[model samples]
Target: MKLSFLVLAGAQLGGVLGLWPQPRSLQTGSSVLKLAPTFDIHVNVAHAPSDLEDAVSRTKGFLRNDKLGRLIVGRGASDSAAIQHARSLNTLQLSLVHGSVVKSITDEARLPLGTRSEEYTLYVPADGSSATITANSTLGLLRGLTTFEQLWYEYGGQVYTVEAPISITDSPAYPYRGLMLDTSRNFFPVSDIKRTLDAMSWVKMSEFHWHVTDSQSFPLRGARP
Candidate 1:
């Protein structure tokens, strides 16, 4: 019997090393990425769904906001600046496209037949010429965008992402990524419910089991035919 621990000399652990529910694979190369202030999102599909468009817009809004406290994955960037002097680097933009990924996560990617998978692959070049997030469905694109934002942090009044030339391929380990709320027992306000759903979507939760009815109370209206 034997055990071995391979240590990453250049890489650190925790927020300093990765994201929450870290990707199944995250390989980092040398260099740093100074995220563009106008870091925009573009969809490559022929006709992006309205919901997908809306998600991309929202992702664009939050990705460049220095005020967003969610980019705490790798906290202190003071000493990690790749380029000390503000030199002209390529302005990187996020591009999302439709694609399938069945490697390693074949079961999760294909199970529950006809399900819209939330599997995605994100690649950011060390040169910073561009970045891309590819997924099999819109759900996957959303997750990719969330991971993109988490890669950035504010340091010395500049937004940057360490560990450049990054490649991440991830999918849910379990098929049921879900959340539930018993509105029949304790109804959350419509606005509050919406906010909760939005947060869940950001975290890439695929299902929301809303308990709208129970033996004690029936609170939801039926859908119109």
Candidate 2:
């Protein structure tokens, strides 16, 4: 009787401890599973510089993260002294903002800039797959990354996967980017100007002209605010 009582207690403990075999369907239903996409990036660079090692390393970190998409950087002219210098600095900045590797460095890149057309000519990869980013300024390139970030964040924590190729042909028609500021017509806030400048940087636009006339004195008090 005592042995039987001990066996009963052991069985009860086993059941309480979940040692009893569970049905396959029940166990399967409790299992957690996830699906993720893969990425393949390509980069094209027109120049390369000596100080690009650290930048490239950090960029590789960004590319390898699952949240961010794949990236590839190709160099066009790594040997050119002038181009190399420019790329060294720009590549560093690009890596900090966008994780793109400088893959191929070459010296035979020619960008077209014309005065008549309003359209901007942006050199992008063919093939109709993968995101193509082209920028004349490091700041503009950073802005592109910000734009991508915004889009990705909007879609929750899902990774951005793209297989479609992009063919971008862009160029600015205006020789000088212009800004019209009218402090006279209406009271303008300083914060507004700062925000506008931030937006302007995204497009690689420089403020060539500012028309801030303080003629209409509605209430000028803050000493050239």
Best by lDDT: 1
Listed per model in order, the count of residue pairs whose N, CA or C atoms clash below 3 Å is 1, 32
Q: Which digits, one per residue and each the tens of the lDDT, describe model 2 over residues 1-225?
A: 999999998655431122111111111111111112333323344354432333344333443452532223322122223222221101112321135333321111112323222231122122223344455433334333433222211013332212112122334434456566666666668898787765564443545244555555555456775
Worst 10 residues of 1 by lDDT: 1-10
Q: Report, for every candidate in turn, its global Cα lDDT versus the true structure.
A: 0.65, 0.33
lDDT, candidate 2, at 216: 58
Worst 10-residue stretch by lDDT in candidate 2?
23-32
Segments in model 1 whose C-alpha atoms lie over 4 Å from true places = 1-18, 66-114, 220-225
> What tens digits encode model 1's per-residue C-alpha lDDT throughout 13-86?
42225376678888876466676655556667655567667766776566555443323455554434454643
As for candidate 1, its clashing pairs are: 15-73
For candidate 1, give the lDDT of residue 10: 30
